[model samples]
Target: MERDFDTTKDVVTNEVKAKKSAQAKADAQLWVVASGKGGVGKTFVTTSLGLTLSKLGHSVVIVDLDLSGANVHTSLGANPSHMNIRHYFEGAKSLQELVIPTTYPRLSYVQGFWDSWTPTDFSYNQIQNLIPELKKLRADYVLVDLGAGALEAHLNLFKTADEKILVTSPEPTSIEKTYRFIEAYMCHSLKENAAPDAFGNMITTLRDHRQRTLSKPFSFKSYLKEQTGISYTFFEALSQKPVRLVVNSCRSQANAELGHSIKSVCHKYYDLGIDFTASINYDNAVWQSVKSRTPALVAQPFTPLAGQFLNSCKHLIDPEELRAVV
Candidate 1:
């Protein structure tokens, strides 16, 4: 694998930096891949998709944003001790300087910090600094691999993506956690955008409703629609932010339909329409490739898993097929 960081390209002029930043933001697409819980092939999907895009002649950069877990480099067959995001976090290097070329043509990645010393939670200033740098990365597609769960940092990072893909397994626990993630993200977005006084009362009502029955399905849409104080732009933003769902490790047709079921639930209760992009079946080649520290698409290019990754990339790259909430 080509794990070299190009340090020869230095001493860039201010005008060149400004022009490059503008060009990158104008051309590149940022895709954030996340999961409700770990153990669901989120990083695998990210690396596979990045390889697929690269094979199609697009410059792809896979960023391991899952700082605490930080294993994208391992999956891509790169040394973990090589220059990573820790250098950027510790002020030893800029974010752009951390980008390292992968073995595949047109593919590169920014490794995450796996050391315990790296902060698990970021402050507001850190997020502000990191996001712009991420947007400025020069690539056709920038794939960010987020850690599992609905942590504030994850949701904040997720909200800024040009494309958001929520990966999940078909198991009952995974499906439930996926729903909880969507709910948490919805509430997080509202907390950030909605009027504080109005949202405060809304939260109290939500808490009261939760106390009625553990089986009661949560519905934030109906309650929010009833409120007259909140601005329409809040609802518009919620309606417009489309999430693409990918169900991984499927064993049967029923397992494949889980993505659709989750999408239906989100539209019903959360007022968000999520695309059921692709369902990848259980394949031993996937694990075998990972065990060898290589992406499945690159190691087993002729396998069924590679075909599925190609299909998923096609669905993801097309902008018109994305469904917005009604």
Candidate 2:
């Protein structure tokens, strides 16, 4: 029988290097829409962002990978016959055949295959397995509304995204939770599955902070640095992948400015500058359409909020950005 073994270490290293080189050539813009916590209107942001992009004539597909509660269908007000990501994974249905067109002709969706994928379900290998199917869509933008929280699966989507949009409203509690979420997220992004003792200790410290009586002197930044200092690998990931912070539910420019504040804070720590784009006003039409199971853009395309979202799409896959440089 033939042996399944590598000829030599030199050959193995060369093969590994070649694979990385090949991967570098296969870059596609995967925009991951995520939040540290749920109920911050992440799905709405994902839907609007995809809708806006499609209107700009870019073939856009929003993949609802929210395994816990797959409501991208309800958000869009469409009753998909096959709302199952599991089927796609089991080879029962091809992703191409799974494309469910919405009110917007330019937009379509790939609903979550798994209805009960917990934190464990967001697997890099499983998600990677699905890419060839997604690649067939080959749109200018592949918008992914990753499941909520700071689970490895959620962070993986953030890790793999070409562009990341972190959304949050202005409520103080929401802001604080979002902060904790981002810090935990970035901490993990810099280091995936670190030592057991150290990881457990960090979680304990975070819990302690949450338990503190009143004064919250301890900071997440200090906590991370104390545990894991910036090293070669950390800096390398930061330099390669940066995130953009987006503020939604702006009652005024002050609400929009909150995004800038958050960006400034991230810059102070991460040395990355986040762009503040596309702030939408409090539109009752959003909820109204939700009751009727309709996408706000389709139900009220002419709303001011709708215009802001489409304008965001214009900037997201800007035509000028795609123009070849001489």
Candidate number achieving the greatest TM-score relative to the actual structure:
1
Error of 2 at 102 (Å): 2.3
Candidate 1 wrong stretches, greater than 4 Å: 1-27, 117-119, 208-219, 319-326
Q: Which 10 successive residues of model 1 have the least lDDT summed?
A: 1-10
Q: Report the lDDT tens digits of candidate 2 across residue range 1-326.
A: 12434447668899999987775555346888887667778889998888777766666788888876777878888775555666777778777677777766668888774445445375678776665566556565678888777777677667667777888888887788767767766667645545667767766765776577426466555555667533225544555455666677778778877887887776664444456666667778888889988888778788888878866766666566443211
Index of the highest-lDDT prediction: 1
Residue pairs in clash, model 2: 77-293, 84-113, 85-112, 85-113, 86-113, 86-114
In order, candidate lDDTs are 0.79, 0.71
> How many residue pairs clash (N, CA or C atoms closer than 3 angstroms) in each of the candidate models, in the order given?
0, 6
lDDT of 2 at 6: 48
Model 1, 216-250: lDDT tens per residue? 56566666777766553555764565778899999
How big is the positional error of residue 109 in model 2, measured in Å on the Cα after superposition? 0.5
Worst 10 residues of 2 by lDDT: 317-326
